[model samples]
Target: MHSAGDPAPPPPGGVLWSLAGDIRGLLMLPAALTLQVAHPAVGAGVDDHSVFRTDPWGRGERSLRSLQLWVYGGEAAAEEGRRLRKLHRTIRGTDTRGRRYHALTPANYAWVHATGFPVYQHASRYLVRPLTRAQERALYREWLQVGRVLGLRDEDMPPTIEDFWPYYRTMLADEVEATTVVRELLAVDAPVPPPDRGPLTLRVALRAAWPLLLPPLARFRRFITVGLMPPDAREAIGLDWTPRQERRLRRFGAVVRVIVPLLPERLRYLPRARAARAAWRAGRGRQG
Candidate 1:
């Protein structure tokens, strides 16, 4: 600590610069953001107030806390109550298209204030909630609860979610990065399939992810909150709706039942459905 007139300590070598670099890394890595966006319980959309940007190195001067951020994610978000009012209109809409979910896609980048579906296929089981502004810093605090409830740490966050892309220019970059990585990873040998694979059911992955979140989520209140909604909202929440997500979590505790183990391990050498039936039979055989 120092008196008001004491000289300030030298900053960590480019600490501000390092943060800026991380911002670029985050902006350029959309998969991380999409993962977080799609993470546990697809949201109604990131609560509008939680998105913020603080620039410590502006050209003019050092005026900390003086940055007046706007609700400017897009044209529709420029005003304070405007965004929420509009969201209230849509979220409360009851028509067919109104009931339809509005998700962000590479093809529809121009849609203002748009967001992707609730990406967390198993999030309902975790009882995820929306984050407030203070929790939005570099997404550092947002993931803290996700990590704690889901048992994750700050370092575990994907770079895409950590960067703060305040305005339009970088938001585009965020999407580009998320889509590109998904494409490359979906290539022939990639562990995860590309988008054209028709939304690869991370259900298996979610099942895999369950073990990671169980300890916390179990002591934590698994499903009751999600099942509060009707069964139909599954797609809207971005879940593959594998049994693990839709069925009660207590039914899944301490168990990992491979939904369809007989499916061809390397694409199709035979009718995939037959393989599934055979797998089911075999599983029953062992159980019997």
Candidate 2:
């Protein structure tokens, strides 16, 4: 394990390095989570322990915070990874059909780890800037390196990004099953404004009228999530996608491309990315 004081080596200079910092990546959270839970074992683990139905936004935010720390928190990142691994070690249980599931199991862990590469890649290409083919390959490899930190062996991953699609397709075809948990996620069965966070104005409004707004918002989110998923994965989860949905999703992505770039850096990235950028500028200043 990497020591607390010792800086974990930086991730590769790749598309991930650019996309990891963009706020647009958050838009992929639902699709990524959907893919993760598409695997029966992974879904079982989440169904057993995750509080998504009660507090989905909190669950999502916590997941994002851990990922940000692991990917960008430098010297402290490895330690955070270790802590998470340790926590998950205690989360083992059987599914409704009595099949065993372990969150720490290597294959299960790797499945969740593998899903993020495509999510961020698509998020960048559709919402930020598109990467070159070589850059895409490099980004995929960087995530493989992250897999090592998350306790997955190299054998657990596809040999290359080009190879990953076949593996992903096979998983969707052979292993993914939509459980009740998947249905709940598709229903967006959790509160917005999180009940504990967000702007006071929004919080007050949501608290006042959440019952009226949540169903429509849930339908809207489900539509986008289905559009974001791969055809095979979308099919595995039985989400309906259509030409109209595709057009709307593309139109939304175009609007995001224009608006996101206009936001200030503080609003555009997570704190870790902002810190990384600040450090880079400071280092350049010293050399000058």
Candidate 3:
């Protein structure tokens, strides 16, 4: 199942990019963004230009939409990548400590891009399914293509998926920090968006109950986010990660793995992914 955004599947061993269009990837968003902002430059960029504070969910929504289009959009995805690369070129500034930063810088872009592989790998264990080592490597290679399309050079990416973990671990140990912006993201105090297409009664109930639910939900979000992090990364971000928390997170993941597949397609995937799956299924039927 190929789409214009990501027109070709990874030759055979790549499962990560193949599943990039899955709604399951959203499970990794918090951790991915958290780790990216660990870089002071990325954090500073968001502080200066991103509307995350004012509209957290909206910012995430737009980011995810762009990714979906890039993966499933084909020629349209190329245009979107070009637009992003052009947009990023205009975003340059100095960090608080007088360090200069540019969104288009290969190193900066690569750090954010590299984080996606591990996030997807980790989240897939529960949100969807697991992959073998060969598939993981293939996924990593496929994303290298994505990085190139987004303006990163080959040298900017890790040489292989095997190389990515050491690089990722080093970034966590040496590069990531909890900036003020990251602290705000980890706080998770923003109101949850009400359901987009649920029954009016369900939406109304959720809206009315949200304030009451916010306290526990916020804690749960932080807990899960931290639980998803490695000790070094969690320590860098100053989030607590205890054995008890790990147990709870594991149980939650177990529940999701069992339940998510049972959800209706409308509930399980975003619109573009739903369409892509439908197209893939239709193509498979024709092949059959």
Candidate 4:
């Protein structure tokens, strides 16, 4: 567990704070997860151990909650980190290549964490404004701080944005693939149930409409999943992106950029983020 001496979570109003909490940030998550499981070891671990196929909504909700905690949960962030490590203790298996893998193997674990940086960088270009060089560097530094909160040592990730790209490119070229999990995640025909959360009325409506909804939903999933991925990473993983798809994505991104900023805080940010921002403001008011 992180002590007082350990690095604090990303401070309020930083690049990570601004992005990670925004509702638009959700658009980037699938791309990051796609990049993650494109690694054979990560793919193997998820295919064998994750409930993603059987319970996609639950798995996604849980993953989202954990991600929110890493940035907005403050002291709870380190505890969440410890919880994740313990959870993955038994998640070991063999990849399609017949090599054994463990979820927490430093390189494997680090790669999963590392995917977020590039995905965030790429997605920001389309969903939000493209980050300035200073903002990009600050985002990387804050990401590293979150990594520390997740119990990653400084050596596990490249030290700076300058060092990170080469490492990312090397992993894309040498380690990533269209593994079983990646294919399933991208597959339009994969059976996924309607979300079971939300009000009873909403849940019932979703269940009734799911059959009709699934096709378009799945296609949209594939679109954003492919479109948001870094071009080099997409090519490395052999996912196709056509010129028409690029134009469509740009149109979609333009709409999102126009709309998202117009939303109020309650509408624009997730629950955890809303609460954290409120608490931080309250604390600052008291200090003043």
Candidate 5:
């Protein structure tokens, strides 16, 4: 139906997920196509690092981690996303220090809001290593506090989830132990490249963060940001998308969520200062 000069466009798997008979799905795709990024582990971790699933559960701008869950299908499908719906139901928090939501403390929330230091985020009470019986008791108390904060019952905890398994609740060492885990997974194992003595810092970061800052362009920023940003800051804000792209993105994210649980377990425990202490001894040995 065309002349020699007119070349045919690529086919969408030969009309399966295709519509309108064009092949610009890649370019014409909407921005709200969120893609869920999961971790090496699965299960409850699915909701862990999720944005909008943040602490003080019903608090300020800070919420769960939702970087890749904006939409799931084409133009029509983009309308009924259930991200926030699932988010609110899963996260848990309450004012322990006082009735005021910020009574969890304005200072602590500020700490997490600005730098995401983890101490102020959910599950922080038990992040340290219990050195003695007393420390273990204190850690247990903190664990209880964390459970209260997350709205998790004793039955919902790591130890009892898939049945009382000891593998989930590993022994703790010290506060530094949790921090060390952070150092290992992100900063240590993936050291930041020395700043290019370039002319622009914002531009460089923008270049690096462009994928997150402007995800449609690249995914490098998203990968780089994994476990680096606070759960809240790592949200799933995006532009209006088409139904098809939404469905496609969601299906893709769902697959990843299945594989990685959409969130990392380490992030959940670390904010509450969860420590994987074996790394500490390993680290010391390396240095020694």
Candidate 6:
């Protein structure tokens, strides 16, 4: 239930609107999720409560949809925020280090959200054009607004882009670790099942070929997940990235940069984003 005075969703043409809905955004998501679970508390919550192992594709799809809604769902954004907070209320457990944890503890919850900014900033250097300094600040400000929509206080996040880096660095140094979930996410043999969505024929084909497909898919997953992470944060979490891998990632990104901008709107933007953008354009046309 949003009111007239409630903070608005990210504006339709904002940096988040442009980036969050873009297909390239999916490449950054695994790195962000990996970073989030590197924190023991977040790791434990997902390990114990999430069905990510049994339903990796479905989980990824749902998470991506929630992310899209945060920027493009308009009034639905605030309601989604409330639903997420409520969803996590009972997700309590002991982490790998035996520390008791709750999913919605301000710091833990905030850390999960916080991973997005750095991952976006870093990965954009390769997958999309680097953000200008002004664009970076604007992105951070808009992200903070999204935070507010998610029930985070002003104090829950760093107040500005300048303040955010130090806070992020401190978190990486003192708290982030290669927790069990982190290892699983980066594992090449983690036993993720074939995706169950799509046409029955496609699903069956995937299941039949999964044994042959999983090996390379897992390697690529690890490559993109670690390669897209901020370098210092990747080191902090102790993931290895060789120079050869770096070159490979750069070549891949170069291809992506050339190709993605050529895609049609319907192909480039996710479904929710494409629809919202259409609505915003129509409303603006009526006013004009």
| Top lDDT hit | 4
lDDT of 5 by residue, 211-271 (tens): 4443332243233233222223233211123456445544553453354333454532222
Candidate 2's residue-wise lDDT over 186-232, tens digit each?
87665555365789998887788878888888887787677777666
Give the range where candidate 2 is weakest over 10 consecutive residues by summed lDDT. Answer: 5-14
The parts of candidate 1 lying over 4 Å away from their true place are 1-23, 26-29, 37-85, 92-288
Worst 10 residues of 4 by lDDT: 1-10
TM-score of each: 0.18, 0.90, 0.85, 0.97, 0.22, 0.97
lDDT of 6 at 20: 95
- The per-residue C-alpha lDDT of model 3 at residue 215 equals 77
Return the TM-score for candidate 1, rounded to 2 decimals: 0.18
Comparing candidate 2 with candidate 5, which one achieves the higher lDDT? Answer: 2
| TM-score computed on alpha carbons, candidate 6 | 0.97
Candidate 2, residue 77: the lDDT equals 74
User: Which digits, one per residue and each the tens of the lDDT, describe model 3 over residues 105-165?
Assistant: 8878899788777777776775666767776777777787777656667789888877878
For 84-143, candidate 4 gives per-residue lDDT tens digits of 989999999898889999998999999999999999999999999899999999999999
Error of 2 at 228 (Å): 1.2
Worst 10 residues of 5 by lDDT: 31-40
Angstrom error at residue 95, model 2: 3.1
lDDT per residue for candidate 6 within 184-240, as digits (tens), equals: 999999888898989999999999999999999999999999999999999999988
After superposition, the stretches of candidate 3 with alpha carbons farther than 4 Å from their true spots are 1-14, 188-208
| TM-score of candidate 3 against the unseen true structure | 0.85
Per-residue alpha-carbon lDDT of candidate 1 for residues 1-288, written as tens digits (9 for 90 to 100): 223432221122212112211211221122223333332112223322122112212311211111111100111112322332344333321212223333222112222212211212122222222333432342333222222222222343333432422322233333222122222212233232111212357546555575555455433222332332223332333323356554554344223123213334332222222343355568778999
Cα RMSD to the true fold for all candidates: 22.4, 2.5, 3.6, 1.2, 24.6, 1.1
